[model samples]
Target: MSGDLLATDIEAYLDAHEQKDLLRFITCGSVDDGKSTLIGRLLYESKLIFDDQLAALEADSKVSGTQGGDLDLALLVDGLAAEREQGITIDVAYRFFTTDRRKFIVADTPGHEQYTRNMVTGASTADVAVILVDARKGLLTQTRRHSYLVSLLGIKTVVLAVNKMDAVGYDQSVAAAIDADYRQFASGIGLDDVTVIPISALRGDNIIETGPNLSWYDGPTLLEYLETVEPVGAATGGPMRMPVQWVTRPDPSFRGFAGQLVAGSVAPGDAVRVLPGGQTSLVERIVTADGDLDVAVAGQSVTLTLADEIDVSRGDVLAAAAEPPAVADQFETSLVWMSDQPMLPGRPYLLKIGTRTVGVSIAQPKYKINVNTMEHTAARTLELNEIGVCNLNLDRAVPFDPYEVNRDMGGFIIIDRLTDVTLAAGMIHFALRRADNVHWQSVEVHKEARAAQAHQKPCVVWFTGLSGSGKSTIANLLEKRLFADGRRTYLLDGDNVRHGLNKDLGFTEADRVENIRRVAEVSKLMVDAGLIVLVSFISPFRAERRMARALLEEGEFVEVYVDTPLEVAESRDPKGLYRKARRGELVNFTGIDSPYEPPEDPEIRVDTTTMTPDEAADRVLRVLRERAILPSAGG
Candidate 1:
């Protein structure tokens, strides 16, 4: 064919595909259960694979094919070299194909146990899941795992393909037994709509076309069902929610909020509310690139112009005024942990929902669900590939719905702030009652009044350094000196507070973080009480220290780093911790096994090697006087 003729044909095909409705589905099962082969067969039988691609598959199959002297259909979707060589799918491979009836995008996901996160990613958007079961093996552990994940992701439709029928001699009884067992299991998991089919993906039986061998099975073929199943319905006529992606203002006159409508519809004159602030406005115009739209429904990208100039920006959600989503700074959520680092409570991460990103911290895990048994086991932390229930505390309030109500508004991702890697995917269950009910009560006597009454500035002197670095000794002497000078002060020694407030916490990284968090909160309360709070602890992590600093007013939390060399501190070994660590009896010992991150820009740096404890206390007091934290010596 001529180049122009080929171009015309391709253009025509593309146009047809654009016109057809799309159905996104996923294929998953145990490893080597022919998931890739089933998808590859669908593409091959539908004539979607190009001639050159077919030629390449044939060439590659001769050396790496699992099947001898036959085209390895699995090679088509298992595109990774390692996958092709290992005869297993390692990642989710998505392929788009169109039949005469409809257009389909299928995700062939990995079936291995370790790749559950990959499966969750692919299934998150799928309308239906086709779970392949090896006929000889029947139902395996991974089959149940993938099935549970599919259900958890809200995939309503399920197709259980009993594959490798040829290997089991196409026996109807074997297929029947497996189908009965799966139906029983699926019912228990709330999977109501399930269709079972017997097929041999390797032999291409009952996949694209029905074969005489499976004449006993009277059901639609896989392609027939895929082409006919209804596409997942859009959230039209629901409460409108459009998370602002960009604030488009090219010229002085035009200011529009641009985003895809995730739910409901909007037209000119419709009332909308900007969320988390509850600012109401009328839709002045629905702007599109071509022209102004009369109406914009779910899934359409449009810019909205408000009748009134309100506080609207990127990361803000615009919702239907009457049915706006709930605004809260805390939520109970189900999380799928995806990172190798275990989730630690009180450690801040980035929570991204819709287009908005906010500082968030996951509370301790309520429980973790064992996918194999569906048992809820109590857990403190979530490791890789685990699912758990936990509370998420956001730095500020944001609008959202329950995941059951609106996936787009309720779904979120937790990102590591420093590494920028996605650590987990979460779905909001409900907002915590405390988030709405707990309000700071206004008091007539404020911080200034309390400080004036005490005759000293309310401050928290935070002493952070390595163990045996004399932080506690210097802080004790400093508190004694301040008390002698008529300053109202209290020293919160680390070991003393740990016995009562942080008694349950150990020396693990996570426990240490929680320990510091509790102490920081206590110090903030003490500062509010107009007392000089001296906190002497080996607060190691910089992030946690910064968190403490953020909780205080400007210049209120003074970080005092006791800069003693590690050699000197270790040689001193006042607590005998370094000796125990050297004997391998102590784990996560700071300055020995675990890290001790010193303050980079502390307000005061006291070198213990150059000064005695009393001298260090004098130096701190002199700095306080210079900073006006204390009254002048003469005054």
Candidate 2:
């Protein structure tokens, strides 16, 4: 049961099944897309059906329950009455069988837009996805959908089984056109590895045998493809990853940890590391209900005892000490929205990473990917079934690698904060690397020492406004005057700070919230060191400004609103951004595209179009003097 296993064990298991191979493939397609029929044909022609299952299919078919059938294969596969009546696969109905050469596990996934979630569930752990497309219909939207989802699910080997070729009179020309179109569409949306096979489940041509009708094609038949396509055990054969399901210390008789081996192999005597806590121990023994196995590979559920006592608990992953995933409080990830409710800022949801569940807030939506075009819309809120990139702030650290690198640690689920429903399935995209600041570490003197050297006092001159309202100009002039007056200070202007301090960020609503959040935190830290901070931002939300004020000393925060009217601010067009916003070229724009909530009561109100930048700056400095945050008006 150690890290390495003899290849014969796997080969022998498949051989003993009396079938072609070890892996099973399931066909997922739309309703009346021949999903059930193709599966039925595979089993029927392969002669795997017992006398009773065939009898049940015939009996159920002849009752005149469904319209289009002497035998509607949908009836044979769809076990539930609800499913048969509705004619859709709601849940994953698994069917098992073995052929002369291999074993199979067919997970019949539903073919509806609403149940794409279920398709994801079925295909998540599948080896190969046989995405069926009707020959006459060519590639449809759901065809693109499932193809995209399979790429997301890490199912690389795909069989584009073109069914209902009989409808096109088994015409090779029509099949070829459909095949070319499908291949082109699939390739356009990350399905380059797909193989299109022409098959007619209804007629049984190219199913088990190559019929005389379609002689132009020389590729493997459906059964031939299933028997030969190598199963991907590579993912399952990675570094050991067992998400701790539970720590079995019942009655304390035998202190052990229990979990399923989500990836790789583990055996007794292998050194394992308990993650999020870096505790290392030697595996003492492996135990399961089915006696003891020397070793267990991926997909096995087993309990283990360590040679030494340690704090190994549920939600902790056990892995080989050499390769452990990243453990952090925060991570960037891609998400597919499943809930009707759109995500929001500062809203907490429970995040399930591997076996670990912790509260999380989507700090920001990086971009929303358009399903049809795969185009990304700069997103603040994600809608139902929409895929997007988001920055999630996790409450606890989790061991994870990028989804493309490691599946077990990288993938996660988000449960709704209120309803407790699973809202999204996410794949981590590694934490954002902080951009190197050439000036970050190098210093002539410490900030506190510099503040001590100039004793006049240090505080923030916060200017809140709508864009292009002279916030930056006023901030710059104020910093210049303070510099001339010999007061110790630095200007953290809106545009300058954005380009320098917050260049890693963007301008969505969530980005706006985070932009304010970050600016506030940095300003607070600056005030603590007694250095005057000049902050000018479109810190539009008065509530957020108030929160920032709450973080400061009683009089430390100064809010200066450049009260230029929306018409005037729009006319200024500091960067032609307003014009773009007006044209709908930009979304979440402060004045035109989005709401800009101004401050009700600011420390100072300077109408930018009415006053000079220097005058506005002087007025702001006067407010600081009046508040006694600065030493004196004439100091």
Candidate 3:
């Protein structure tokens, strides 16, 4: 490959490049496995480096090169200052090159276990994965981890590039031993298609031209293998599916749904169904800026106009009527936790799959896979870079395929509800059987009828504060006052509930989250029964409090903040909790070791230091009367 054609005929070069198809691949392995070096060498051998880049490479190599002052090829792809200084890839670096046979997009992914999420982000779209290994180090933990991930992500083709052969005198036995060991492990992980090649990425041996050093090995060179392989993505010729990304309504007469087709082909007059609703229509036209397409296949972005006006919106899927995808509200999925915050089961998160984002909550993990040993160990929650299998419950049903069937429809990301940060990536295994079997039975009398008969509006009065801050005392007094005024009421104190419902839970952060979640659900049921439910608990985390608030209808959940100083509350430690915590008898105790995030905004705030518990109870009743939650005394 040379630039002689570029210098003489630029248009001819562009035409030649346009005709060739593209192959997206990633280079990944353990740290110091020369992933950047191999990609840099590939770019250099393909003649994709510009003149200025070559000059800079030569100049910068002396200052930061791992090799003794030679033109460090790794410097070409290591673009970050920290990457060059640390001699390891931290972020995914993508580069493009073109050969006569094909064009190529290569991503250099990080190798550290801490950056496994970064590697997953790069490999999610790749058609192939080139896993480099050090000949001297043999196989390491990260090598097995990335290999398992490659298989997990459904990249069927794998190239095991054994790098640094020159460091081992180009020994054929060294490469053979490593390949055999990997194959034995790969068999257990269902990795069937593996091509092993020996090469020195620094010396460009067996990478481009099969240098004479490896005379014993007879395999396709790294570049030759990449140029010939089929670059089919995870989903190709399946049922037609295009998740509507936008509704183009430039004018009322012209309405179309615009999105990229993830599978199969669509044409005008084809009967299509809008999913999760199953509304049938015919494709009126395939619109594009260039012109109208008579037919469009997967991987093409176009606007589709239906034969009839339908309720198609963003987050809805357009699919072939004959082979529509499955719709469900629950699924068993493989989850990769990417955030530093440990996953909390039953906590709400936004699940974004394809173009749709829905409310979802994960259950406790069934098991987490040990990437190195391939063992399934029990785990309560997933930490950063951990993989687990868990069940997820969605707020509503959505159309999807199994991850093995179609990546676009099956893969999804879990996002934090409040912060809007991506916390995990997940793949749907299949719809859970319970989701299909379970249905809400219709009732003759609903919550409104129950409330009307009781002659009052139902709500949950949530009282949250530090321990010994008068939450329980105020709630008890408030319930008695409401009862005397001819109102149905119930009180749920934290300690009393722990004696029965939450006996199994501990004082850890995860247990506290689950405890609040259970109480919140109970309170919701009590509210539906047409009674005023009082909840008094030291719910520490703000996120959990927000979760509880979201479970109720507008104006149905009232938050009362008991504003008592921690020192004052500690001085009146009614249960001796503060003294026990100070003596190291109670770990993860709020106001001492753990955190308590007070509500920034609440419906009512009572400073217990200035008011008595009876006065706080009376204040809550007065606010309730003003808000029309109860009948006013004047009326």
Candidate 4:
């Protein structure tokens, strides 16, 4: 039928292709598991490769072929030079093909454990997961890891293709054993809909057609199943939701919200409500570039004009008035840590969900999942490629559904606030109960009123440096000077707070972040009471220091860097910490085992190597006066 359509009627072939359903799937498994070969075979069988591409694949196969003197089918998709030279996939390679029944977008992802994050990225939007396993190395570590990820990403359909049956001599018992083992593992990981098949991608045994070697196996070929199996349905039946990507205003009288509808459908006169704000209005028109649309369904990008002019903006969700998503500032979530740097609790990151990006921080992980055994082990932090359950706290409220209910609304990515690099991918399970129960109570006496009564502006003077760099000494002297000037001041020394407020915390990176978080909160409360709060600590990470600064308003948080060289601080060794760190007695000691990030731009820089403690304190006092935190000496 495909040959006749191409030979006789090009228009007919184009029409049939346009009407065919599209399936987006990913091929993932352990390294050298034939994921690329399987995709190449699929494209080859579908006749999607151009003549020039086929010539290149054939020529390159001889020079870089792992299969001596034979055509290396994996070269068809392993296009990267590094991938070809290493004989392994380093990045995801995508290919498009069409059969008589359907069209496909296949992602051939890297199978190495280090590239698991790349697999997650490819699987995020997939409708199916075709997890390949080398029949010789049945059910390896990455097979289980990818299987667990497939389940976590809410992929309902999975085809467990056991490849290289030709190598295993078409052993039915071996295939049966692997099937049983994978079924047990899949059941444990909540993967219910899975189909297992044995094939040799190198030889094209059971991919497009059943070969004579697999006479004992009675199942559809991989192509047959893929063409017939139903793809996961889109969210067209769920609550209507469209996150405003932009506000389109082309003319003086025209204003519309532009976005792709992620769920359900909308029509003219449909009542819609803006989320995280709860403003209601009726949809007046659905505008598209082609013209105005009377109706728009999920997955359609359109511009919507409302009957009433409301405060709808980008990052705001437009939803069905009666069935809007939940709004919360905290959520219980499952996180897949992707960065090489371990996830640090209490350190601020950015959470980007839908079109919205908000300031967010992760709490201590509840537990990390062991992909092999499916066990929940206690975890303090998540390292690279680790999956963990954690609670996320956001600075502002966001509207979302449970990931199981709506992928677009519930899925989010954690980005480094300073570098803007994505650190992790997370799926929301549900909003924490505390998010609903906790509310800020209205106060009669606010910070402005308290500051006015005290006759001075409130601020947090955060002193950060190496442990022996005179942060505490300079802060103490500065506090005494302020108090002598009739200023209400409170000094929070790091060591003093550790004995009381942070007694339970330790010296790990995660613990240090938490320590700074607690101290920052306490300082915020003190400043609210119209007092000058002096915070002295070895606040090493810039992320945590930035978190502390974000708690206060602009100009209300003054960073005073107490600068001293590591050698100078070690020689001073006021508390013998550097000696202990060098002797391996103290772990996670800043400037030794751990790290210390000096402020790039501080309000005041006090170099203790060049000045005495009194001079350092006097320099900070002068900066405070210039910033108007304290009254002038004449006043």
The TM-scores of all predictions, comma-separated, are 0.94, 0.66, 0.97, 0.96
Q: Give per-residue CA lDDT, model 3, range 1-635, as digits (tens).
A: 32677789998888877878878999999999899899889889888798999999988999999889998999988899999888989999999888889888899999989999999999999999999999999999999999999989988888999999999999999999999998888888988888999999999999998978998988899999998987444447988999999999999799999999999999999999999899999999999999999999999999999989889999999999999999999999999999999999988889999999999989999999999888999998999999999999999999999998899999999999889999999999999988657779988888889887777789999999999999999999999988988888889999999999999998888889999999999999989898899999999988888899999999999999999999999999999999999999999999999999999999999999999999999999999988888855454
Residue lDDT tens for model 2, 1-635: 21122244765654455434467566787667888777877778766677998888888877634535576666667887778777666777778766655678888888887777777777766789899989888778777777788777777788988888888888888777877887787777666677888888888889888898777789999888887787443357778888999888777679878989887888889999989899999898899987778998887889988899889878998998787666776777888888776665655578998788997878657788766667778866787777888888777777887887666778899997546799889888887544222235566665557556676566677888888888888888888888887777877766777887788777876567667878888998887667888888888766567667866776677778889898888888879998887788888888776678878877789987779988888888787777765665454
State candidate 1's TM-score.
0.94
Ranking by lDDT: 3, 4, 1, 2
The candidate, 1 or 3, that scores higher on lDDT is 3
Clash total of candidate 4: 0
List all candidate RMSDs to the true structure.
2.6, 9.9, 1.6, 1.8
lDDT of each: 0.90, 0.78, 0.92, 0.91
The TM-score between candidate 3 and the true structure equals: 0.97
Question: Per-residue lDDT for 349-420 in model 1, tens only?
Answer: 899999999999889999999999999999888999999999999999999988877888999999998789
lDDT for model 4 comes to: 0.91
Instruction: Give the per-residue lDDT digits (tens) of candidate 4, residues 65-96.
Output: 88885778899999999998999998988889
Best by TM-score: 3
